[model samples]
Target: MNGDIKEDIRSLSLTDLEKFFADQNEKTFRANQVYEWFWKKSCRSINDMTNLSKPVRKILEDHFSFPVLHIEKEYISRDRTVKSTFRLHDRLMIEGVLIPDGNRTTACISSQVGCQLGCTFCATGLFGFKRNLAFTEIFDQVVELTNQSLHHFNVPLSNIVLMGMGEPLLNYEEVKRAILMITSEDGLGMSPQRITLSTVGIPNMIRKLADDHLRIHLAISLHTADNVKRSIIVPLNKKYPLEELRDALKYYHEKTGKRFTLEYLMFANMNDSLSDAHNLAEFCKSFPVKINLIGYNQVPDLDFKRPESGKIIAFKEFLEKKNMIVNIRKSRGEDIEAACGQLALKDRNQREG
Candidate 1:
């Protein structure tokens, strides 16, 4: 550890905080109060903990540091979807979006500064990999977006989607820690059922999540059922493959007894045919799952286009006929580049340049 760098208080667990307080000759209860300030109040600085005595506050200020995100840019779509670009302490940028549909407001947040898995159609992959976000950084995105939903729509956030930029399972440990903080009574206190984690089907990680028995919803990005076609779009599939992914999902279902979700992006003339639908339906038969058929969101320099309405309808009808639950989720915030697979760090780079 660098001698000049103070410890980040947010990184310490409650027990660790208590130990530090004990060493300082302060009561252990002070740890609980500080934890509440760090998590419940989302305080960015020690000065904001006015409830602490001046002497204790001074000591904390000298020994600890809090790193918080600064909102760099915010955009609201005509559909009332809000997207915010946040600048980290190291100046890397990440995005979070608040999407409102009737009574439900979902916060879609990122887990990494940039993405390592170079999915061919994703904008975030264009920037290449930067680093995984700390647990506090992930938790902060939810708190910020929850506040945004309340401020803009006068409604609390009802759902969370780990689908904004990076593959969440790649940052599994920090993401899991952030989820615990979000659902803890001392923190945001949201139910696990309302949270959904979407991944690009990392097989071993999927099995690990099942072994841990986490009840939060899981979504697999399965763009196509054909192994070769899927690998072309999502390169990670080349490593995990379709057979391994299917077995992993089955294991997950058998262990948790929870139905997972399959996210399919329909691209024009690419994977939107009736045959494609039949293949997808057959794949879902391996486990209890629902299909979320998303229309492709155009990214800069990408050749793919959204499937035609007639083609989309035909494909969905085919799946429904096969007794598979299917939903066609419309792309939101397209005008502001806030739709699925559209998140990039270019704005931050341009500003820095």
Candidate 2:
């Protein structure tokens, strides 16, 4: 790369692209057309912009680079979930999962190369923080996964979840931009209601998201309601405790009038007691929230074990008795390491080691 080379054209917004085209003495409408190709069509090369003149395409190729993620490895589970390990331009790896359930398919995409929040129960945390993915990188996961869903299941992706690899709120700006591109009429034209952003409960950032007034759903990874127990598992909870998170969720619910989901992973002999269920039930009373009881997916080197069926049933019954909405989210693709909390690039980690 040369100092004189232009930046990634995909990084430019429509307004920036318009200015660039204007400076090039080209019609401003060309910018909109090119922007459509970059985002809407997810074109990987300047040559893919067939609507543009050869001279214009040549100019783009000479000035800008379209560094797209290449699928280095793909694993499919018996349950038909697909986990893909993508190699970025610098060869850093990130993972994304395509989860299928009947007619609906969900794309679980990553926002960063690795995770900054070191939740003890998570595999991504084992890698430490690598880098925040570019907005293009985030959007590319959705595009690629959507294609996979259509190809494998003969159905388009019905939902998108920012629940893979990294804490989405940490890469707020890029995630925000990616969401805008994803839901824009000229881009994917997907409904924001179909997207969910999951976080390990970053309080101030959660409040900020409320202020932004986005229509997407939010899911808080609140494995335990007790602050002491929570902090031991999700280390970020020490910074943003349950009280702060409660206030943030209150604000978010009041502002958007949208019900959010609280994700609780049931671990055997760990936060699966009757008292723990009571604490979680009380926590949900603060805001309009649905409880998603998820079974722990075994990760290498982690001592946490999935709770028995009887314990999960007892916990769900307890929440239901409290007049709270609860759904048990079945773990998908665990055999292929594509289940909930299992999106870490384990093969890459082994290779790096």
**Best TM-score among the predictions, by candidate number:** 1
Superposition error at 304 for model 1 (Å): 0.6
State the weakest 10-residue window (summed lDDT) of model 2. 344-353
Candidate 1 per-residue C-alpha lDDT over 1-353 given as tens digits, one digit per residue, 9 for 90 to 100 = 25989888899999999998999999999999999998888887898998899999999889978888877789999999988999888887898899999978999999997799999999988877788999999999998898898899899999999998788899999999999889989888899999999999999999999997668999999999999899999998889999999999999999999999999999998899998988888788878789999999999888899988899989989888888888999999999999999998556473242
Q: List, residue by residue over 29-86, the lDDT tens digit for candidate 2.
A: 9999999998788898899999999999998888788888887888999999999988
Q: Candidate 2, clashing residue pairs?
A: none
lDDT of 2 at 156: 91
lDDT of 2: 0.90
- Cα misplacement distance, residue 113 of candidate 1 (Å): 0.9
Clashing pairs for model 1 are: none
